[model samples]
Target: MEPVLLAAVVLFAGAYAFINGFHDVSNSVATSVRTRALTPTVAVVLASVFNLTGALLSTALALVLADRFIQLPAGTPGLGILIAGLLAACGWGLWTWWRRMPSSSTHALVGGIVGSGAASTLVGGPNIAESYQVLLQQIVLPLLLSPVIAFVLAYLLVFPTTWLMRYSSPRRGDAGNRIAQSVFTSAFSLGHGMQDGQRTMAVIVLALVAAGFSGTTGIPLWVQIFSGVALAAGSLFGGWRISRTLGSRLVRIDPLRGMSATAVSSSMLFLGAVWLQIPLSSTQTMTSAIVGAGANQRFSTVRFIPLREILVTWLVTAPVTALLGGILFLAISPLL
Candidate 1:
């Protein structure tokens, strides 16, 4: 019974990673595809390859998630919390993806954990305060600030990029811009793997800990490969609906601005994952960068209705997932 339940937890974690890829990886390539820098197929392939590379390269952020997030109890009850949290995150990812909305998988996962942690208290689980503290200090604060910074940095970056290209012929500039977009989108996908890959890895590690197979948060190589492959597979599948929203509905993006957005977002993702050991939303950073770069051309070019809808969803994602996680945990605890 215990082994079967552990397998179920692993299965759900894989599902979250796949849903994450379907929903979030598209952000890395949306601008590149829209700008004709890469065809849809090429972009998705590049993203999948680099995302796997990035996932395999590091476990720094994954360590933070395992050690600092929440304390998972030993046995089936702990597995139940993880199952509920994963389901909540997966459900939110699918819902937002279906709506063609680009939402944060990172936040959804954190909210799910926080929600499940709170619910676990009823079953003599660890205090929820620790999870709450980390959520605010680590996840929520960064979530609020990173998007604004991505927007401003991208907005400023467009000035210099445009200025540098001003002297070049349109044909020459377009060619250079395409190359730049491709390179930056690859880098962004690599960074996305680093940021989001750790998320699923952390959840898997937590599951292992709960099952009493491991005494520490050390990530096994097999676990890393499994998480990487799941995410990469999802990336291969891609999310064209949300990609269309990001590529066309939010702003009219040109090759130069698209390159600038990718550059800014990729740099931010690297900074957050490698240096800060923090998780960031590739979707949030990329979307904000697109808007930022587009606003530089003309604010009117930024569509408010769609942007408003995205913002509302972003604002509600954590809270709504938290509630959903709690409900799911409560509902499933008895069976587990």
Candidate 2:
């Protein structure tokens, strides 16, 4: 890739990270805002700081995301292909965010890449369709299982936590738990930055390798530094709508419920990042945990309608983004 193309790839990847900072990262602090443990402004600021730190904290997850989910015969995708896929994901993200729906950025990105990879078949590139098997094991299976794990664990976990606090005065326990919730929210936000934010780091790495600026396994320091900053900057603005949806309309998130959900999501991310070394979707985990927390009270009280809408969005995001990415790549392939 030329310097111009490389620059464009960097910019697009950064922009995607920035959008993710607001769109996906909002899930981490939605409960904090709803429970009034942290005000909206405070939550955004705090999350931004922690997310930036987390983005820079490791390159392992970055490698996980940008590595060969769809390995090209050329080793990596071309500039045009990456741009098409990323832009497709970005468009889907912006659309969903504007509509105040909590969809998975992970799905959008994977879809975009898959779609673009398919398009490569038209240009005599290796069949990226062959990659679905690898991806099914690495990406798809985990995505299917994450929510199930989060829901069960969160539902079970909420009972013990609430029961243990049963004897403490409601007002007094609430006060102390808010602080605990804040700490958990902060940790969750950190994991959000590292796990979700690093998807963009992976994009940058793939771009670098394609551009001959870095190796597939090696992440440049500049990529880490810039992705963190871009994500933090994006988190600083326009997260309120997504925040509102996750915090309020999903289910009434009292401090305990909030803490329960936050803890579960944080644990999921931590395990994925450290032990499993996979790129899990915080949006999916958060929603599942939130549902678990709410359903623990009563099934009808959880508001199944909004969750259905979110589920629809999640179900379609991948195939839709993938389709969009394929079309965009095909349209632009001749130029590269």
Candidate 3:
């Protein structure tokens, strides 16, 4: 039973990574695609490559997730919760993607785990207080503040970036901004991979520990490769509908603004993943950055309705997914 449950957990984790890839790829490439900095194919390829590279480079955030956020009991019960949580996260991801909403996959996963963890506590799992403290300090705070910071910084960044190109003609400015946007797109893709890939890695590690495959909650190379490859494949597939939401519908973004948004987002990603060792929603940060850059140009240029809708989605994602995950755990645990 443990072996079978472990296999299922690993498989579901990979699938979740794949869903996350296409689901969140828009964050890295949307602005560049919108501004014509890169063709869709080129942008996707760039994202895939860098995302894979980023996934390979970091385990710090993964460690934090596996060790700090929530601990699962060994054997069947733990594996069952993880499987249900992944399913709930995946379901929300697919729904949001279908609706072309730029929601936070990070929040969804966290919510799922939280719900599952809470459920587990009802059945003799570890105390939820410590995990909740970690969640608030590490996950919730960073996820919430990063977007607001991204918005403000991107808004301010437009001043410098815009000034630098003020002397250039439209054609020349677009060309320069395209080149810069591509550079930042690569950086953002790398950071996105590192941050999001770690989420998958942490899940796989938890599964491994619960299965007794490993006594420790460390991310192994095979786990990294597995998570990275699945995520990269998803990125290669791309999410055209959500891409359109972030790239075009959110704002009529110019190349310069696109570059600024990506820059701001990538910086925040690095800060969260590398320095803070926290999980952030690249979706929120990038989307907020895009809005900030757009908002700086003219209030009317930034569409409020979609922004409002996206915000509502963000606000509700955790709690809704938590409910879904908890319900899923209850429904599926018996069968397992």
Candidate 4:
């Protein structure tokens, strides 16, 4: 690949990362903002800043995931595949955003990559492993289990805490819990930065490596800083639509419930980033936590309609994006 082409690919990847950041920022701060724990502007600013700080805190996991997923065998993938994958991911993301549905950008990107890779390999012929263990163990497992774990954890954690505090004065408890909620919200923002922000960095790094601008697993400092800043800026802008859905429509979040959900999400996210080394979606985990917390309050608190929409979005994100990716790859293959 020529230097100019490589640079162009890197730039495209950066833009994709920025989109990811802006699109997903609401996942971290929506609850806090909706509950009046933070004003929208303040929530966005704080979340964005912490997110940037968190990105600087972790690089190893992102690098590993990037190497595993993005850098295909030399000559196995071409520019067409890359463009298709990105466009498909972006397109699916925008579709979900338009409907105010909470979908997984991570899944969309993964689907795009898989679809494009499969298509490119079928056409160009590469001996890449179709059934890599990392894909199953790291990507699939986390995606399948993280939400369940978050839901159960939040459900279990919230009720007991609330029960214990039942005898306390409501006003005092609310005030104290509000302060605690703020702390937990900040922690959630930090964890969100650590986990979710790294995903964009990983994607950009993968693009650079794919275009031969960077060696495998070696993400540039500028790339990291740029991705971090872009994501933070996006968070600062915030996504109020999703925030309303997650924070209010899902359940009425008292400070205790909010704190419980945030804690569970942060814990799951950090474990995935540091131990499991998987790039799980913060939005999914948090949503599950919210559901769990709501169920703990009352089974009826979990709204089935909105949840069904979310599930449908999740189910469709991968396949639809994959199909789009495959089609786009084919269409652009002639030019590339």
Candidate 5:
């Protein structure tokens, strides 16, 4: 039974990765495509290749997630809860993608795990304090601050960039900006792969350890390849609806502005998160940077309605996934 459950968990985790790939590729490619820095096909293809290569950049993030996410009781975790959590997360991810909403797969996964794991505590899991710590230190802190960091850094850098490039004529400026944007896009995709892409491995390893299927919880080479490949494949497909939402609805992207945003976002991920081995939401990081870029030119250039909608989605993602995850736990508990 444990073996069966382990297999299922691994499959679910892979599915989640595939879903996450499509969900987030937009974050990296949207601006580039929007600004005409790269055609949509080229942008997506670039993201896929870069993401695939950087997928296993580090295992620290996987360790952090597997160890810190949910503290189950001693004996063994209820496989039902783990399975249900993954399913709920995947469901939420797909739903949001269909709705053209750019939601965080990490957010959905955390919410699903918390909701289901919290319910398992009723049967003999650890205290809620552990979950709280996971939320505060691991999830919430990174989620809230990373985006702000992305925004601030992007906002600050743009003015200087704008000033320095002011002397160049339109054609020269456009050429320079395109070259810079290409570099920035590649860098951001690498960072995105290192940070967000490793999470799929983390979740699967967590489930393996929790279920006692694997002796070790560390992310193995196989797990890295598996997760990375799945995510990259999803990115290749690309989320057109979400991409449109990110690329168009929020702000009209220009090459110079998009380059600034991508540069800031990549720096933040590589230094602020990846160096620290933390799982930052690429979705939020990229979107916030784009917002900051727009605001750098003029505050009014950004559309409030779509921005508001994405915020509302972010705000509700946790609790709603929590509810769904808990309900799923109940429904599946009997089988386990």
Candidate 6:
């Protein structure tokens, strides 16, 4: 790749990292804000700070997984593919924003890369089956499972705790629940750093590798630091629109329920970060945990209406972005 073009690709990837941070900010703070445990500004600031810390401290598991999924063949025309992928992701993001639907930027990026890979195959580029399998196992399976797991777990955990606390004074119960919420919220922030922040780090590493600037052995410290800063800055800005939907629209969350949900979600995210090294969607995991906690109280606690919209976005994200990526790649290839 030409030096100038590679620089442009790296810059574009950084922009994507920032957008990913902004797009997913709600995942980290929505429950805390909605429950009034933390103000929106305070919640975001804390989450942002923790996000940067997590990125800096955690291992680069997601980066390796992503590289496996989207590695272009040696001598593959990378500039066109990179540009198309970024453009396609941006297009999907804009569409989601316009519709006021919260979608996964990670999914959008995957879609773009897959689309470009398919386009490359049409012109006799390297096979990408390994990448596809990684996507299926890591991304798709987790998306399907996280919410169901969260809903079940939350439902089971919340009701029992509620029942146990029923005889207590409301004031006493609130105080205890608030304390628990604080702990769970902190844990969730750490997990958010481990899981969500790592996704951007992975992308940055991928861009560097593509540009012949890094390797699979490990990510450079500067890359880790820069990616962390970008993501944190984006989180600090926050996304109020999606936060409302997640924090309030999903269900009425008291401190106890909030703690239960956050704890379960954080557990899942941390496991993914530490063990699987797969890039699971924090939004999906947390939402599922929230649903599970709500379901523990009653099936009615799980709001099906907003969930229906989210499901639609989830289903459409991969295919639509993939198609867009393919189109963009084809259009830009000749110019390159």
Give per-residue CA lDDT, model 4, range 1-336, as digits (tens).
Answer: 445445555565666666666777777777777667777777777888888988878887778877775546443154456667778887887677777788787888778867776777666745235535666777867887888889889989976788878888988777667777777777777777777667777766666665666675466788778778877777776556777778877777877788788888888878878887777888799899988877776545777888998988888888898888888777766555
- C-alpha displacement of 152 in model 4, angstroms? 0.3
Candidate 3, lDDT over the whole model: 0.88
List runs of model 5 lying over 4 Å from the truth: 73-76, 123-129, 215-217
| C-alpha lDDT of candidate 4 relative to the true structure | 0.74
Cα lDDT of model 5 by residue, 264-306, tens digit:
8888778744567677888888899998887877645889999
Between the candidate structures 2 and 3, which one is better when assessed by TM-score?
3
Off by over 4 Å in 6: none
lDDT of 2 by residue, 89-186 (tens): 89999999999998888888889988888898878766667778978888888998999999899889878988899899999878877888899889
Candidate 2 stretches with Cα past 4 Å from truth are: 73-77, 298-300
Candidate 5 weakest ten by summed lDDT: 71-80
Q: Give the TM-score of candidate 5.
A: 0.94
Candidate 4, poorest ten consecutive residues by summed lDDT: 70-79
lDDT over C-alpha atoms for residue 111 of model 3: 90
Whole-model lDDT for model 5 versus the true structure?
0.81
Model 3: residues with Cα > 4 Å off, grouped in runs: 122-127
Give the per-residue lDDT of model 3 (tens digit) for 132-236: 887898889989998889999999999998888888999999999899899999999999999999999998898888888884446788999999999999999
The digit string of per-residue lDDT tens for model 1 on 209-266 reads 9898874558999889988998999999977889889999999999999999999999
lDDT per model, in order?
0.88, 0.82, 0.88, 0.74, 0.81, 0.73
How far out, in Å, is residue 170 in model 1?
Answer: 1.6
Q: TM-score for all predictions?
A: 0.97, 0.95, 0.96, 0.92, 0.94, 0.91
Error of 2 at 310 (Å): 0.3
Clashing pairs in 6: 69-131, 150-288, 150-289, 151-292, 154-292, 154-293, 155-292, 155-293, 155-295, 155-296
- Candidate 3 residue 222 Cα shift, in angstroms, is 1.0
